[model samples]
Target chain A: MDPFRKAIKGYDHDRIPVWFMRQAGRYLPSYMKYRQRMGIEEMMSSPDVIVDVTHDPVDRIGVDAAIIFADITTPLSGMGLRVRFLDSVGPVVENNIEKSGISAVEEFDPSSFSHPVLKAISKYRERYADPLIGFAGGPVTLLSYIISDGVDRDLFRVKRMMITEEKAYQAVMTRLTDMIIEFARMQISAGVDAFQIFDSWAGYLSPGEYEHFVKPYVYDILQELSGSIPTIYFSTMTSSYVADMDLPADFYSIDWRIDMKRFSAEIPDEKGIQGNLDPAIVNYDYALHEASKIVEAASGRDRYIFNTGHGLLPSTDPEKLKRLVEYVHSVNL
Target chain B: MDPFRKAIKGYDHDRIPVWFMRQAGRYLPSYMKYRQRMGIEEMMSSPDVIVDVTHDPVDRIGVDAAIIFADITTPLSGMGLRVRFLDSVGPVVENNIEKSGISAVEEFDPSSFSHPVLKAISKYRERYADPLIGFAGGPVTLLSYIISDGVDRDLFRVKRMMITEEKAYQAVMTRLTDMIIEFARMQISAGVDAFQIFDSWAGYLSPGEYEHFVKPYVYDILQELSGSIPTIYFSTMTSSYVADMDLPADFYSIDWRIDMKRFSAEIPDEKGIQGNLDPAIVNYDYALHEASKIVEAASGRDRYIFNTGHGLLPSTDPEKLKRLVEYVHSVNL
Candidate 1:
């Protein structure tokens, strides 16, 4: 088995499986140059360029896994949601999840996400035999972004819709969760080995709502995908509920807020664990030093994946990331 | 003794001391009318207006204590360091902490504070005869706003300066800590009953840096205000470190990220707790239903202060808020 698979499974590995959340992002000089030479819009428009950017980190840094180069909203984009990536504002979706009637939204089906995304995932996988992780947004976070039509500070619009226009929001979530489960299932069937359900905005949900609104939807997705591929339920700024969150995720990816050593004790033994480091700390000179400290912080845990509490910031230099990969490899005693 | 006062002292009260974090803001029709009549500039400028807004929830909603009405950067405006409060942008600054040479920064000349603010503190003591609380920005968080000149998605400039411009950043923190200690101390001198240190951005710091750069400054602020009045340390989005983080503050004003009952056990018995409710939960009836469940979740805890994990959003309606407040007070054990 691949070392990355071994690490995610908590089995012995030759070295720590190292991969970054946004390794395909703007931080790499080559990624920027690739943008200039290859044309900015061309990369996202073509499967080849997307896959090239996806594998760039692996070649540049020798990372153990290659996450497919795609945004969480790409599926929605295929479903007629126009998205504009702003330098400062992130994604700007002109159209939203809320249409006047269900019939109007039915025209924009998520099943339409096939040719462009599948091709890109396939090409990215071909570039490496290592663990290639595919990702999709969980129901709550996905709908929150869609309805807001862009990046929101607190997903206020989502909460408003969840309260005032709930049937519409649940309609969207039902569609999205069905799409996501299928989305992850297709990736696993398409030869992608591991998957992550990124609940990027899970901090927005309350415990009661988490149990009712979010849990069943996510559990359905995970349970359906169970045994086929490892599924990581990861959310930043959220450690309030996971020990007994009752999710069906095969592994939990956490932020630095929870003590991972105690977290391993809290969650069931059958479940694998990853992360809890502050990603911004990677920008520190003591990157290796802090990574080691974080590793030691999770020392008593049996199965663990080394990752940051959140995704990489746009300001992070890719070189430090390259150094982090090499460093984690050396220190995984 | 007031339950709020008793709660602060880690004493048993029949009920938890409950107060919404942004108790006095937009939720009230009276507040909107007051802000409209007074204007934001006038609302902040007039001590009489400030005192009125601070007292509205205390008078109307009957919350536990009155936190002083002012923004964190209001004192910077006092210092002639440029700051702005945009309608949508929250607080903005012309000069950041990095450039605001701490060594050159004079000791807080009490004369610099607006006349109304001082008078407001006095009036809250004289007129209301209730427990009044005061606040100051934790050094790093204020410095972050200073460096960014506004609220930034990531405090990269602040983080980068901490690494690159170490001496300058340290001097800024050292001076800010001194000013905060004095500012907090002045509130006591001005007759405020309790103080809170707002580390809104401290969640951005890594545990290592949080322990070193941030905690010491926090310790100094808490230590300087020690025995004068009880102090609380509030961090937004800090669920990962709920159990392990150790700052010298007397209370942890936590967010929705940590479990309320489990969280109560994590903090030392000597310290009190302020919150664990998700403000977003108030939007949905299910969320509202769950919000009440969160109060029950903490039913057995001692020395707890009931509050939203963070400030109430501007969109939160007063009717729902009034119900939420009544809900917390009604069933709290």
Candidate 2:
């Protein structure tokens, strides 16, 4: 099997198919210079720049996969939502989704979504030969910005919608899921090696709601991708729901908060498992030196793709990450 | 048994010992009216108002327990390094910790830490006469905020400290642990029914680091609290580490991402367990109705206390919460 295929099988690759959550990030001095010169909006807007930046870490650090360098909110930008990446104040929106916006949802066109993404995908495919993960925000996540009136700490606004305006919430979920299905399908058609559904905040859903509101749409998207592409389904703090809900993805990248032994035991034998190391462990110098021990602690007799509980922070030294990579390689069973 | 004592023992009460993470807040009309009258700065300053608001939910919502109303950043506020809650951008610290702020560390009097908290205890002692949880930020949590450098999407600044400056991290950790030890001690001293260490960010620390930097101190704190207070070592996603480490905690509050069957199985039976609910479930229209299903799922367990995976969001409706309460009460073991 292809190493990438082997990777999705939960098989330990010859050199552990390791990739940082945000590998193409500020941690790369090269990317910093690009950010300084081009600015985030300019880079995101230009497919050429997106392709160049996407390959920055793959070619440089030599990881197993090259996730397309794009923000989770990329698809939603077409919906007349002004998502501005204000240097440091992460992906800010001018208008948080209010009842006004929800009622007017049909007025927006899917074509209005950003064009640079398609251009970037076509271009990035040409640049990096490794598995390129095409991903999108889960339905509820996109709906969060809409409900919070902007960005909120606990997503109270949307949660309220779940209780009060169940139909509106369902309508929003249907819309975002439809968008993501198209978004992800487009990537596979464009010849991306593998696709992963980045449900970064999916764990927020109860199993029943996840199954009702989310899984069907995600399953639809995966099917639209033609199922030929090896796919990874990832979420944070979602151990309970995923166990009960049958998702068709090849891997589940969970946060480190899960009980690994139980997760390993319960998740169906055929599926792949990724993640979840404590990203903060990098903060402990001892952790940098002892990554192998950490892996050994979480490892079980299953296909485990070693990754962090969450994204690697900006402060993580390249040297520590390098050490972590070597550490995972050493432990690949 | 005293309901508070039952809370410590991990027994589900007749009403199932419910308390909202931030029970008293902007959501309540009464809290808003009181807070508006007193002013925001004076709200935190005056123990009277804080205590009154702490008891507000008990009077209004009929929650089983009342958590002391306070900010996670309260302890760090006194260091006089210019910490204030901003109207638009919550919790503004004008001064990010340089080495100079560390100098002010010695001036911190841990005994005085819980004085206002004691005042809260005195104020509400006879009112509800149930479990009154007193909370403080745990080590890594304090490190995340006390030195609020930037958006800690993944706790980078603090993790970098742990990696590069073990001594510095330890110094910070020791001070925080000492302060918390003092804080928790004071809460215990104040005749509060139980204690909850809000290690909201504990899931950020990897297993090894958690075992080293976090657990030992937690063990010591629990050892010191030593059967006096029922403790809940609650965090978002630390189940991976909690399964491995031996901490002297009476209970664990798990995130909803974890499947309860696995969580219940993996977490040793020596201590009681609470939580592992999907917060998004709370957002569903039949949230309380669905929550009863969740409680029913976990109902057979002898040592489980029911709660959400995390706290309620600011926008969580009173009706949904009321439903959750109704459902938990309706569940049959």
Candidate 3:
């Protein structure tokens, strides 16, 4: 069995599955070369380039999994939204769906959407021995990108719509979840072994708000996709909602705020756990020391995956990342 | 006795002490008039201006306590750091001490430093019967500003220094705590009723890291000043550290992430609690509804202070703030 697959099942594997959240992105020299050669739109649209970039990090850093190289906002573009990745500003949506109104939010057939991503996953799977992980933004995060301005913008319209326009909010959430389910199914058919849902901004909502607005939809997606593939829920900054999170995903990928020992005790052993390493500590020596602390915390747990609390920052040195990966692989749990 | 003081003592009061964090600044039109007339530094330097701005929210909104109008970084200038406030960019430091090295850090006497702020406190105390809150950024936050660029900057140097340069880190933390003690004493001497230490960035560290690097120094400051004045520790982000916090403060002013009911149950009733309405909810009706939830969460506790989870956003309307304040004041419980 694949090391990533075995680890996700809470089985003792030959080696602990180690993969950085953004191991496939800009930090690698090979990725930078492609980025410079082609604009973002061109590179993202090219399936062959996506295959190469996704494989580059796993080859260089010896990670246990190869996540498909695609932007979270790419799926939104599949729904007919005009999305652009600017130089330093990150992703920007030309036709902000929030202002366009929720009535404008229509579900698209994921089988017909984001062909490049599906093609990349298929190609990567043909070559890679490790599990190929596919991912998309959680309903709220994807919805926030198009409707609300950036993550920090007072989620005025989104929060207000959640209340005043409950029907509209429910419609958008249901449509996004359905599209997400389709997106996951497409990736699974494309030969990916796992799926991870990135709810990067779920921490912004209060528990009651999350329950009312986000949980049901997230659970709906996860419950539908559970038996098909090993589903991982990457919920950031919402450690306080641990007890309240009733999602049926196989794994919960928490951010750095959580205490792994306590989390393991609270969560059932059958469920797997990944990450909680602080990505902000950029110094190589400190990162290694912190990684050791995480390993120690996660010790004795039946299922544990080594990864960062968030993405590997652009400024993060690839060599440091390699060393961290090497260190985690060398740990004898 | 002042309602704020009575509430802090966990004594029964005629009304719940309602105050908002970041209450005095940009949200009010009267405060904006002074801001438009002079730059931030000029306005902050004028004692008469600070007094008027500090009282404007109390006069307009009828909050229980009057928080002194000042920036958390104001004291860094007293430590010889070149702190400046720019138009859109908030606070900037010309000679960022982080680059200057932690060895360059020094403690300054608050008695002779920031005369305008002290005079403002004195002036406000003479006029207002309510308790006036005096604040300083927690040691780690202040140290971060001088050493690192901003809150978002990868805390490479600070995190590294915490581990590698322990002595230097301790020196900086010790000097910061000392200076904070002096700053709080100055405010206390000027007749402010209580002190609030804003550890806005405390959420960045894990429990072990926080315990090793931050907890001791913060405890030292609060312990030293315990009897002199009611010291409130307003820690942000790290709610997991609630079980670990050993600081003896009159109140722990927590952010919105915390569940007040759980927090109150965990903490002793003799200690007061303040805060945590989410400021991001922009709709007046929604804010009031959320405020009612907070009140309910905080119900049955012997002592509770009503306030926002964080600072009031610049976009938040003064009218909504007034209504929320009015609603809290009218609550019978």
- Give TM-scores for every candidate, taking all chains together and pairing residue i with residue i: 0.92, 0.84, 0.95
In CAPRI terms, where does candidate 1 land? medium
DockQ-derived CAPRI band for the predicted complex in model 2 = acceptable
Who wins the TM-score comparison?
Answer: 3
The 10-residue segment of model 2 chain B with minimum total lDDT is B99-108
Real contacts retained, model 2: 0.50
| Candidate 2 local lDDT, A1-333, one digit each (tens) | 545557665555555567768878887888788888887878888888778778877667666777788887777666656677765567766655563567544433545554787778888777656777777776677676555444653555665676677787778777777777777767676767777777776666655567666677777766665457777777776655566667667777777655566667668877777776666565455654555654664455445566776677676667767776766766645
DockQ of all models, two decimals each: 0.52, 0.40, 0.51
lDDT of 3: 0.80
Model 1 clashing residue pairs (backbone): A257-B240, A257-B241, A258-B240, B96-B146, B97-B146
Candidates in order have lDDT scores of 0.73, 0.68, 0.80
lDDT of 1 by residue, B243-276 (tens): 5667667888887766666777677777777777
Best first by DockQ, ranked: 1, 3, 2
Predicted structure with the largest lDDT when compared to the true one: 3
Q: Write the per-residue lDDT of candidate 3 for residues B258-319, one digit (tens) a residue.
A: 66666676677677788877777734587777778778878567778998878888878888
